[model samples]
Target: MIKTTRIPKLYVYQKVIIVFAALIIPVYFVNLLMNMKGQSFIKQEFSDSIQSKAQFYSNQLDDQISFIRNQQLQVVNDSDLQKLNFLSGTLDVFEEIQLVNRVKERLSTIQNSSDYLLNTGVYMKSFGRTISTQSGINKLPNQEYEIIGKLYSNSNKSSIYYQGGRLFFIEAANNSSVIVYLELSVKKLEKTLDQLVGNYGYSGAFITNEDFSYYISSKHDDSIVRKIQDNVSVEQSNKNDDSHILKFGDQSYRITYNHISTLGLSLYSYMNQNELTGSLKTFNIWLLVMSLVSVVIIIVFSFSVKLMIHNPLKELIAAFRTLETDNLDILIRPKNDIEFGYLYRSFDKMIDKLRQSIRQNYEQKMALQHSELKQLQSQIKPHFLYNGFFNIYMMCKAKDYETVATLAQKLGSYYQFVTRSGADEVPFDMEYRHAMDYVEIQRIRFSNRIHVVAGEIPDACKHLMVPRLILQPIIENTFEHAFENERKGGNIHITVTYEKKSLYICVEDDGNKLTDERLQALQKKLANCSIVLEKTGIINVCRRIQLEYGKPSGVFVSRSEHGGLKAEVIIHFNYGGGSDV
Candidate 1:
């Protein structure tokens, strides 16, 4: 053996270098391959997007051409153009031109500027008479003679033909009297096509006739023209193949063809492959750099994995162990390393889960309490119904026919108020009416022994929303508790007033003073801590207000200034002067 020491440092260096090279090399090549694949995918996707856009534009253009043609046919059938042609005695060309100008102006107003069409004109076969304001007298074609002859032979059907290198003839209703043509300029159409191509990063466009004899190119490329013309034998053949990618003179391109039958032309949009792959190339360069960086990070982290990951995990485990013995207030601290930060966050999430569990438990308990409270409320309604029906039965049994009839009617009305259909909210005036009805019935029972006083309730509060039967129970409680056994005259006063986000209803009775124990018991019931169902009318009122309007409402019982029991109900009023209770 050649001088072997305790630990071999060269082995460690060799392993590190080997690991570094192994990580970086694959990262570079894999990044390059991925870049190429991504670029190819992007190019194909971009070409497809462009092809779809061209096809949509082509269809729209075709519809516009057909619409213009139909409109021209209607103009040709117009009796005015025929009348102008049939008129004798030295034709007034000036007035006729003026009328044509007016018609052209009106048509121009309706046609979109991007549509590439001009005015509809009438051409007469006899004497080569033409009425066109779009084409001036100087711009009139000398070939108008042959064009009119062709018009008379074709009759009143629509046809399309190219003329004068700049204009497209959209001829409709070619008859003996007139040939109506909607002139669309090729320059405008070319501009529109160019705009469409530019929007989709396309380089050029080519338009060809049905027979492929004539063609116009946006880029003036003769090779593209020859290639497309040779490939498409007929107009129908153009529709068979919509898209293709071709290589032309060291450049790759994607061409999408749309056959427009309405205009008798085929549109081909040629896009450069470079434009589609441009963004992909940028993304590949970024990905290559990122991948290389990731590989370096992975290798560095692999060797340092124990120091970076294991130490923090141990610390987190120790902190978690402490949680078993300690309260929920245990604090966890992680190391400065990024890998350790992740573990720290995980620990924090665990603690958060524990806290959330405790909160959920509390919420469940509260929900159970709420459910029990609702069941109690449901029971109260049936109890009231039973008592009301029993009272009616007793009156009927006593054979007091008049009192039974009146009481039955009042009871029916009271039940109707209690069990009214619709929303939970009722008008404040309705609640007041119900309270007054209950007091009237109590007045009959108590005779002149009880005196009731109600203050002026505002008309504006008539439509203001409040809970049904909210005030009635409080007033009924006053009569039952204060005036029930009082021999002397008892007075009950009801006053309602609005005071800054709350509605205050004061029900005071001048009767026997309540002992401190009774007052405390009443307060407990109002606060919802007491479970006395018989005394729950006040509790029901409090609970309903709390449920409907939340914590801002309840009943308050104290000694009255008039030397008796005084009950005050505070209900929260919402923003629109309506009691949520």
Candidate 2:
């Protein structure tokens, strides 16, 4: 051999299988436990939802059956059936039978008679005639004949009892001697079972009489129905529970039996274990796939941990150094080896984390700046107070004693209302008064150049809660911006309306034309402001609304039809009363 080099057999022969098994075993068990828990939750939820729907449908069916029975009894109590029964003349027997047949056909034609999960029929004891919607007119067999006679004997009360493989019912109206027999249909009952199975994903079955001779099944074998019938009888004999789950072989089934006292028939619901767990099937498949993937990922992760952890730290440090120098464009892609592949992933994760941290810091800074701006804007209220004082000073200097006295009283009351506030929310009546006072002060300053016309606040909404000073600011803005250029005949209209769920206040002015540029600028300024101009008196009402009620509840501004600006503020009533702006 040329240079005779031997490869190390230890590396190739190492027990990787043992290492993989040790890692995967615990993971598989954990996955199984999680799957079982999740499946149980889904199955319980599905069962509850379906159970509610089934009970609803069952109640509807019972109502429909009761309605049809009532209608049939009413027909017996009517004139037609009585006339057919109580004829006194010497009548041909065959002709009388033909007349009875016509009457029976007419009653069968009633709408919804076929919809009942039972066969409806009329049995006449007088003519020995039994007219069934299912079997047509025929002479009743001796046994049915005897049963019908017994029913007619006890006709004072409506009778419901079972015989043969069917439920039988007879009701005789006091006005007529006609006897009606209603037979429950097995096929219709089976259809109801199918509907329940389709809706709830559970199989069901029913049996009639104590012997369990007549039976219906829903996807289960006839033997299972028979076995359940036997068990139900034994339980009833022992006076035990009527519902229980039976496991036969690998399958499990839940059986619930109810003895319908009116018809003497046993109604039941059968549920399969697999059907109950049907919703869990998809989750189990996904759990299995994830378990397999987890094992492979763990192996790869363990192999590259040491190398991957070190290189990424180095690259991240270099990137951070560049970032310190304000170079945000540094790339940190690792090599293509297994260890470096993991390193690249770690670097990508670090970059995402850093980006998130930076975004969070920026948001916090913006919030702080916004808070400061709001504090500054709230100082505008004091400026308005000072302006009111200035008006009072001028009134006194003019030597008009009556005017000065009246203005001073109004100013005192306005300041009292503004400064004496404890809670931010006030009654609509009080808020309205505050707005009127502000407008009155503005009227004194502007004289007859500005006129404020406010509509009557409804007594129903008077007690409704509203933010303090909500309407005053909009009124102030109308006078300050809208009527600033108007010489005379400027009108400000304020209307309050109460809707079903919300209160609306509309303030419109007929002063100056609101230009598109001003509207755009106002929108931009309101958007940038920390507190909404709509929430605060002049500068921050919109921002306060955004903070308090969020974006959906805020101030909206537009040009009124009167060729001036309109400011609309919407306040929604909350549980603690009206929400803060």
Candidate 3:
């Protein structure tokens, strides 16, 4: 009896669920992580875009400030200012007036060319006289006079100042104790800021100095600016600013600041977090919907598997279960699904084939038993047993005790080998000894009329298991058929050798009983396997070899160098065993 180990098993529906979860869970997590990464990327891109635009606006403001400075330079280098030189007493009243008119007209031209300029004027510090494009020859108050002079003395060549919502560039006139000023408006600055903040709903303020006093701003709620004022630390305001995100109240803001160093002003933009991540939120929603839809699809697929595969396979398994009771009379019902229908049909057909094979095996067993009985009956004839005893008795009467004992021992071994019903295969040495015994008995019977020669059988080959009586039948054929006419000088030679992963057993006889046609017919019969079982004697041995080691290791017949028949039995070392029955 054999014992088999049991293995853990998963049902079809369980496997389906496991496989679906295995595939879906990873995809869900991967999609979630990808969405998170995408949101981060979007935020970074928005940050970079806003910073770049803010820098652009800062550069534009710098250029405008540079334009005002250049205008001041033009005024200081004016030839009319050099010719007038308010302190010079060389000019008459009319000439001095004309000089001042020339300077005002030039200043008018310089102010009119720039879109952002509000006013341009020249103020004389030595005489307390002011000439302007906006106001005509106004004398400053004693207090204003001291302030303006101080402002002029302290100004390092040129400087910008913001007073009462007005931006100005002031410079000293060349070669004269005079001050020149140009005031700028906010129209162009507002338009540029609108362009930058239009796409996203971002609002900001422009601060001229570090103080949160007076500033220019777009139309935004006052609370937002107040929130920024309350939250922006002194360190954050004064430092070389980098873009950042901030949380104020219940809302989040992306805060960025760009500073124009020349004007001592900074532009601060505040973007709502919701607006910046709106698209990414939409993407996350879409991904979530797809995940839900995937789960629904998996559920539907699992249900389909239960209907189409699991149920049908269950029926097939139940049908196979009947086989445990040695029942082959199972009728598997057909399925509506085409694949399962075909499977059910094939399974039914296989069962039918198994039943037919079982019946045929029973009949073959009966036939084999009948054939074995007939063979035993033929082998154990009264004449063979009586002749063997009589020969022994004569040997004993002639006082040949040793020869008699040897003959009796050979006879016992031959009968013992022939009568074996348990094993189909025996070791090569045992078969070799049995064949030698048969040959010895033949030699005793034929006397000097026949001879037997067996070549050296290597020790390595003596242990190989070959079919019992595989060799004896060939030697028996030589006496029965080969030397049927004459026995004198009859020769039998045997050789065994191994080569090319196969063992070859050769038996040759010197008796020339077969003609060319008969030898050819015998060779053809040995090679043809369809009629192998119909053959007797040597052909039967050839068939047994074919059955044992397959066709490549079957017997071959040829004309021997001894001028007679040679039968070679080929057996492979790798041939598997066969049933004795």
In order, candidate lDDTs are: 0.66, 0.65, 0.74
Stretches of candidate 2 exceeding 4 Å from the true structure: 1-34, 90-102, 109-112, 117-120, 125-167, 172-177, 199-202, 207-213, 217-220, 230-244, 256-264, 278-289, 309-581
The alpha-carbon lDDT assigned to residue 572 of candidate 3 equals 77
Q: What's the CA error at residue 560 for candidate 1, in Å?
A: 46
Best candidate (score: lDDT): 3
* lDDT, candidate 3, 1-581, per-residue tens: 89999987989887988888899999888988898898998898988988888888788778877776777887887878766764446678898888888988888888887777877777765545777776666767543334445555664454866555656777775454767877677656666666777666545545435566756665444677777677668536556656776777777887777778767776777788888887777887899798999889888988888988898889888888887688887888684659989889878887886787577764664455345333532454466567678888988899989888888998898788877666667788888989898888766655547778887698777777777777887888787687656846688899999765578889998877767898898888887954655645676676666655667777788899888898888887554333222
Give the clash total for candidate 3.
0
- Residue-level lDDT of model 2, residues 455-547, one tens digit each, is 789877888766566677678788878776667658888899877656788999876667989977776666565643443454466555444
Model 3: how far residue 100 lies from native, Å: 7.1
Give the 10-residue window scoring lowest on summed lDDT in candidate 1. Answer: 136-145
Candidate 3 or 2, higher TM-score: 3
Give the C-alpha lDDT of model 3.
Answer: 0.74
lDDT of 2: 0.65
In terms of TM-score, which candidate is stronger, 1 or 2? 1
**Cand. 2 TM to true fold:** 0.41
